[model samples]
Target: MNRRGFLIGLAAVPVITGAGVSVAASRYTPDYEPLLARLLALQGKTLQSSGSWNPSQIFQHLAQSVQGSLEGFPEHKAAWFSHTVGPLALQVFKAAGAMQHPLDQPIPGMAALDPALSVDYALGHLVATLQNFNEATGLQPHFAYGNLSKADYLAAHQLHIEQHLSQISVVA
Candidate 1:
């Protein structure tokens, strides 16, 4: 190929490869310092308040939702992870990184929390879960949807958190 053709090919290579790289970088796994900082910001607050749902509830609910949603659409589970979970998780982590106090432990009766609690927990988990992923070691366990790297699993987990965050925000 001529120089111009080679240069054109080089430029296209970055454009194509960058898409994949960005996607991969966007995948969630726990990240520590930032998430911890966010969590610390909550300080004396309840982390979650009345009318909120907790992180655990958000996780359980989303998992159940995914299970239900996939019941008849088994073939699309992989795509769902890539399209829904992947990006969502990344966004949650980014958001969490900006927060003050993000929860990690299970808040009691969090499953039944109100919208207020739900929003706080969701935001907290968005960071905590990412920190968990970052701190995790070894291969990530596989879900019915597919095997995810530590990054992707954390990302998927964050997606659930973000979902609850949205719900709480809407009702707020």
Candidate 2:
């Protein structure tokens, strides 16, 4: 009711939201099977794309992200963003069990997508890249999200794929 009370309430918002994010991210279980299963399901489907990127280009982009963790991304956000905003965003994504970002945006500093990349080839590359990520020992810090535990990275990757999946569908 009072201006002071209103200000106090507003200031409490982040504290409350932060607590919720912390709890949600902690309780969220990381599952890699769905990622693999979804890819496997795409094995023989005719997919129609509704996004700027083709089915192959989409897969290529996803593969590049996974590879970036293993090899290294060419560039990254400033340390401030990578350490602060990036992690905060990731917490929200983990808390919500999804990622919301520009669907067509390529990973910064990466090569452009190859129109010549076939759907099947890109699909296989993603599958293999994911496997390599799983087997790799050290993960490079994410370009934006900074260093993530393998679990968080896997969860992030899975959510990223889930988000992209929304842009395409199997054509019967």
* Highest TM-score model number: 2
List the pairs of residues colliding in candidate 2: none
Residues 1-172 of candidate 2 have per-residue lDDT tens digits of 9999999999999999899998998877778877798898897678768898889999999999999999999999999999989999999999998899999999999999996778888988999999898888899999999999999899889989889989879989
Query: Scored by Cα lDDT, where does model 1 land?
Result: 0.44
How do the residues 11-125 of candidate 1 rate in per-residue lDDT, one tens digit apiece? 9996775566556555434544553564445434543322344543554444433332223222333556756554444444444432122333332222332333454455454
TM-score of each: 0.34, 0.91
Query: Which regions of candidate 2 fall more than 4 Å away from where they truly are?
Result: 1-12
**What TM-score would you give candidate 1 relative to the actual structure?**
0.34
Global lDDT scores for all candidate models: 0.44, 0.91
Residue 154 accuracy (lDDT) in model 1: 49
Model 2 TM-score on a 0 to 1 scale? 0.91
Candidate 1 ranges beyond 4 A from true positions: 1-31, 47-133, 142-145, 163-172
